[model samples]
Target: AREVGMPLKMARAVQVGGPAWHWANFAKVARNFEWEKKVGNSVVVREAVGVVGCITPWNFPLSQITLKIAPAMAAGCTVVLKPSEIAPVNAMILAEIIHDAGVPAGVFNLVNGTGPVVGEVLGTHPQVDMVSFTGSTGAGKRVSELASQSVKRVTLELGGKSASVILDDANFEAAVKGTVSACMLNSGQTCSAHTRMLVPASRYEEVRALAQAAVARFSIGPSLDEASKLGPLVSAAQRDRVLNFIRIGIAEGADVIAGGPDTPATGKGYFVQPTVLGIKASDTLAQEEIFGPVLVVIPYRDEEDAVTIANNTIYGLGGAVWSASDEHAVKVARRIRTGQIDINGGPFNGSAPFGGYKQSGNGRENGIYGFEEFLEFKAMQFKPSAG
Candidate 1:
């Protein structure tokens, strides 16, 4: 709560959004399912044994935690939550909220420790029926492997190296600003952030200028600052990781058109300015997910090249396509290999399914799609007796 400067009430609201939203939508789904149910000759469905192990990440700490916790509880499953050790304070607050919400004791449990110690234990625990993890692909793979030993179901939301394609016919100003803002959001810590921008060669210089201006305008300061648009990376290690990418970008001969490899001496905390890199499609900067306020601008010859460059990444999480005409933008978006594609300046709706293809990991989260992750389906058939 203190880290983001959110009030106790607002923090609670944010943490509880997942559960509240899930149940609200779940009720609608349940009602609809009931309407479809015929009262005769159907095998009765019975509730099974229920227990869930939820492992959440540091970014969007409370939100992710609640997403798993709330749905599990709503589905009649007891939960044991192991929040990221990097942001334990927020998790502690969440535990308090769960306790105050009058939830049962064994229904909700919060354990605080690093991934190796606590996370590993939870994943391998025989008592945990399922494991829900949100983190890097590497860690998620380990979680899946360990949980598989017990034949426990696993749901993972992992990393992304998303792309943003700005069509030749798109408004350069709007496209540039949108891409920059997307990368700057949450200091670019978001898994689905459009960090790689593909712009047409004709408007390359123009787009670069607009991106530089957008980066320059970003306010990087203490997390508590109301006016600060870009806060520090989650920790010192995260800050270093982002800085290393910046270093690699410079070393790989990409143009650092805007912010570069320097932390402000005035600030004692972990902070990095929003950086914009003008690079070729082949550059390393264009291929990696910095997960910071870092943007890679790659110029493409045409629509085909743009799509090629965008899909070159192993990650296919989320992306955006901008064009003068909605029809044109949708055409480009359809070709890109991503789970979610935004047209124009479309807002991110939590109601939609969020996940990825390829190495970005499997399965979806959010909306009815996410809820189905907990469900198991079976079809039964019977033949009428011949008398």
Candidate 2:
């Protein structure tokens, strides 16, 4: 909690819950070897992708590291990790734990340094067979460029501006509350947070009221404070960036329905108000990732218009759709272009596949899908002697 100013509960998601979930997945599940089969005179086998290079971001210091390393280990692939310098301590502690657990010295190596020093080398190194990265879209693009020099296999999980679509049939109160809580999680620093809310134009005024009321329930303070539901952002730069986005949103015609770019009353920590914006689909606030406790609510004409507005972005990471019927909710969710979406405030399933699509990112994490990212197909052939 103290490491990144994350609330204790949110911090636990990385410090404890993440490792536990990945380990449980391994210990409880049965491996599927059905893909190893014969065709003609050859048999196909799944082999490790060899040395994997993992470049993780600071927002999820430990969880992202585990997400990459655990599956790499399960697939019999060695790893070289470059954890974000902004949040480096937990990774070092994890390395020590691995060493004490008697993992071979070279099997898992930790090199703590800046992105240029460690991340770039890992991307272009001849010996590194694959590179897995999580960060901004710009950084991910740089990683891909460097990895291309070595023909390195790459997986990226980057930024998001996901939408929460509230259909007319959905229980308005429940959906609005759920969306607000989800957006403010980790103070909206999460890569896949549902930062955008889409509502029917007919009910726009009604939703704005609901959204304001929902967000009013959040109490911002120090991570350790018992009264605090939302914590300060990671750093000064992060705080400024978020506030700037808020300002830009307003300049570009977004209305500040709840909180604006104003400084918080705390007068100390790097804090920005937990804000909500009323905006159009084309507004920069609705399209780009603000990456803080900011939500942009947009109004759409109809169901089809809602889906179109939801997908009208450079990102396709995560989103949510609410409706009276599960089938109807899913039908809308299917139309949105994203990696994952929730149906009527469905709980996050840690074991399910998670990642992004489009500029948001490429590849998957979590469950067997993530495990496959570290594997490669190889066919062993033998010529038959006169049978």
Candidate 3:
């Protein structure tokens, strides 16, 4: 819990509802699937991939584990899960729950250790049929490489440096405020957070001012504080990492519009100020994932320029577009190369396929698409019956 800074409400919702949602999705998909189907004179069948390795991240620990475990089990595949060592408490509770619920022995195994040890073993084990991972892009590449040796199917949910494009006609106040919240969510550690806010060059000053004001209003306190709008990062190392990025941004000629690399006076937890930087689209600050409560504002000349700036990153996990007209926002969203785009602050659909394109990693998760990751297909030839 100290690692991810998950608020009570967020943690409770995931603990209470995440499993139900996963199970319901699995049941619904299982019922709808054609278990045995005929194609001409042949039969096509779907079967469970034998063993699945579920490597979950510290952020949203319980839900990430459940999302991978539930679907794999529902598809009749046994699992070996490696929860992040930084926050393994909740996963332990989950394991107890599984035992209490009477899941078959050896069906679900839990291993506690560092990623380099336990995680690497799972990735390279010949007995493991598939591996599903969520973490940094560099680590995901390592996992993919290890799993490749075993010829195991691998699915990765990696890092992102997503952009939020505020069209020239968008509501400046709403877009700026919304983008700030999106960037600051989970203390800006969320992989899909829209850390780069792209605004029209004509309104860059206006948007930057509004964003600074909005960020100024955010309350920073302990994660458990009822009034805290922002919390400390996962660890001291993470705190230093983010601070280094902020320092790098300033060194690269970007202006710190709000917040800075200054450490909070608390001197206990790993806290960082909510920082915003005014930078060019090509600046290092605009292209990299800080993975903290640090946002970069970029100016675009036109709609085409906005799309170009948004798609310039190697990571394309998530993004958003805002405009008065839904059609216009979607037009701009479609031009951006990302796995998912939120138009005008659309509500998140839990059932939608979630993953990414480019270096953001491969394969899909959530809904029916995620469940199918633990399955394989077979076709059998048969003679046609004659009357």
Candidate 4:
């Protein structure tokens, strides 16, 4: 809690206990997969992709590291990790744990530095067989370009400007409240957070009011304070980046219904107010990943417009759709070009696939799909002995 203002309760969950749980899950899944198969006169087999370069983001520092490292190790691939400089302590602690657990020294290595200096090497290194990265879209693009030089396998889970679609027939209050809560989770630092909200135009006024109410309920304070519901951004630069996005929204004539582009009263830390903006799909706020407790509610004329708005972003990471019927919501969800979408505020499923589409980045993470990213396939052919 003290190191970076991670919520007191969530600090343990995110840094310590959560990583532990995920590591065990990764181990379990790793052991259960079939390594080889026989077809006709041939046997096909899976092998480690050799050395893997893992570049993780700071938002869910430990958890993201665990996601990349666990599966890479499970696939029998050696790893070289470069954690975000902003929250590198967790990676150090995790290294200690790995050392204590007696993992071979060469199997895993940690290098700490800025993305430009260290990340570039990981992406371009010829010895590294694969690279898995999680961060901004711009950075991911650079990673891809560098990795392409060596023809290395690359999997990226990058930025998102996901939307929360509330159908006219859905539970309006529940959906609005849930969307606001999700947008503010981790103080909105999450890459997959639903930062945009799409609702029927007829209910714009109602949604505005509901969104305002929900924003008011969030209490910002020092992370250790029991009453605090939100905390500071990871660094001052990040805080300024989010505030700049909010300012752009204002200049673009978007409605600031909840919070504004002002620094919070808690002057010491990088705190942005839990804000909600009413805007059109073309507004900057509706398209960018502000990475703060900010939400943009863009009204849609109908179901078609809602789907159109949801798919308008350069990102296609995560999203949500709410409807009276589960089938209706699922139907709408299928049309949205996102990696994952919540139905009626469904909970995050670690066991399911996660990642993105389009500029949000390529490849899936989590579950068996993530484990497969670090493996290569080979086939051996032989004639049958018996005629």
Per-residue lDDT for 1-387 in model 3, tens only?
Answer: 355775555545644476667767777887787778889888998899989999998877777887799888888899999999998988898899899999999999999999999999999998999999999999999999999898999999999999999998899899999999989987898999999999988887898789889998888887776677787788888889999999999998988889999887755678899999999887888878899999999998988888989999999999999999999999888889999899998866778888999999998888788888888999999877886
Ranking by lDDT: 4, 2, 3, 1
* Residue-level lDDT tens digits of model 4 in 1-387: 665676787777666687788788889998899999998889999999999999999888888898899999999999999999988998998899899999998999999999999999999888998999999999999999999999999999999999999999999999999999889988999889989999999999999999999999988988888778888888889889988988998999988998887787985788989999899888878777889999999999999999998998889999999999999999999999999999998998888889999998888888788898888999999988986
Candidate-wise lDDT, in order: 0.79, 0.89, 0.87, 0.90
Candidate No. with top TM-score? 4
Winner on TM-score between 1 and 2 is: 2
Best by lDDT: 4
Q: Candidate 2: where is the Cα deviation over 4 Å?
A: 27-35, 383-387
Candidate 1: tens digits of C-alpha lDDT, residues 1-387: 345332234345544554466656755543443222223444334232367888998777877876677656655678888988877787797678778978778888988898999999999998988898999988999999999999998888888888899987888888889988887777888889999998888887888788888888877666666566667776788889999999998898988889888986537577887899888888888877788889998988988998999999888999999999999999888899899998998987777888888878777777666665665544344455576
Kindly provide the TM-score of model 3 when superposed on the true structure, using C-alpha atoms: 0.96
In TM-score terms, candidate 2 sits at: 0.96
lDDT of 4 at 333: 97
**Model 4, runs deviating above 4 Å:** none
- The TM-score values for the models, in the order shown, are 0.91, 0.96, 0.96, 0.98
Q: Provide the clashing-pair count of each candidate structure.
A: 0, 0, 0, 0
Once fitted onto the true fold, the runs of candidate 1 whose alpha carbons sit more than 4 angstroms away are 4-49, 380-387
After superposition, the stretches of candidate 3 with alpha carbons farther than 4 Å from their true spots are 1-3, 14-20
Clashes of 4: 0
Candidate 1 lDDT (Cα, 0 to 1)? 0.79
Between candidates 1 and 2, the one scoring higher on lDDT is 2
